[model samples]
Target: MAIKFKSLPRKNPQDLVAPEKFYASAVGDGEVTMDSLAEMISYQCTVTEADCYAVLISLEKNIVSELAQGRIVKLGRLGNFQIGISSDGMITPEEVNASSITKTRINFRPGKKLRLLLNDLSFKKVG
Candidate 1:
């Protein structure tokens, strides 16, 4: 008996939805878990559970660590990710001079490669 092969459907780059969409939808409706997202991706991509987790884990670790530290960690050129400070106090220029403003937060600036990859909506093949 001969094995028959079936081609997968062609997916347009634009058709790729951001994970944020699902996150927003989940948040708007109810809570969703990491397992749920992993399952979803695995099902859609025909990937293994481990693969899904690996990808998610890497992303989570990088994002969290970048946000936690004071250094700007850029993800190869997607965009600039930074810690924003919202101050609602009256501090005159004189006061600014009096005390040194300390940064207890971290910011990230993505490199040009990351930005280009993101803007292109595609991941580059790394050797």
Candidate 2:
């Protein structure tokens, strides 16, 4: 299976007079819902569908709890997730503090195995 992409007109940030260029943007095929994911996992082992669903629910809860505590959650080959922030810069080094933070975001760094899967990616352009 190959990924699908569509062309989108994008403007150059550096060149004010440059013509808009078309860039390839990925198009998602579909989503695998949690229920569907649990069903798929149930088929792989002795676990029941209900059990798989419960585990996924618990995993989500734990991941959120850990992230709230400012801890990085590393899922082995699945890579690590941590909280990242954007803040307003202060003039003095000591002037910066929590109030400087504008927003927080979850950051994911893909592991080697996960990135390796991308090597086989093929694109199909959307009409």
Candidate 3:
């Protein structure tokens, strides 16, 4: 299926009044729940829905734990998940410390398989 997108006007940073151009933004139709995901996985493999659901739950928990410990978690061909931080820069390297960190966010770098899959995706315009 084609990914749907909508046209959105973005204001220029220099000139706030005039819009730079209309950009294509994704419009999500709806969310697919965990149950749906499990069912879909079960249909394509020998694994049952219950087993898939359990694996998914365990995967989520382990990923979170690893990220919390400032470790990168790689899920085989899926991708690598890591904790990225935004921090205030210091003039001297010695002055910088953990306290300088302002925010921490989860970063996902898609693996080759995922990138390949995205290359075959089609797009559709939405209202």
As for candidate 3, its clashing pairs are none
Residue-by-residue lDDT tens digits, candidate 1, 35-113: 8888888988879878898888898788778776744555554655666553334466555432354443545566777
Q: What lDDT does candidate 3 reach at residue 76?
A: 81
Question: What lDDT does the true structure give each of the candidates?
Answer: 0.57, 0.94, 0.91
Per-candidate TM equals 0.42, 0.90, 0.84
lDDT of 2 by residue, 1-76 (tens): 8899999999899996899999999998999988998999999999999999999999999999999999999989
lDDT of 3 by residue, 1-127 (tens): 9889999988888898885788899988799988899999999999999999999889899999989988999888889999999999999999889999999889999999888988898999978
TM match of model 2 to true structure: 0.90
Model 1 lowest lDDT segment of ten: 20-29
Between candidates 1 and 2, the one scoring higher on lDDT is: 2
Which residue runs does candidate 3 get wrong by more than 4 Å?
Answer: 13-20
Model 3 weakest lDDT span, ten residues long: 11-20
Error of 3 at 58 (Å): 0.9
The better candidate by lDDT, 2 or 3, is 2
Please state every model's RMSD to the true fold in angstroms.
15.7, 1.7, 2.0
lDDT of 2 at 91: 92
Ranking by lDDT: 2, 3, 1
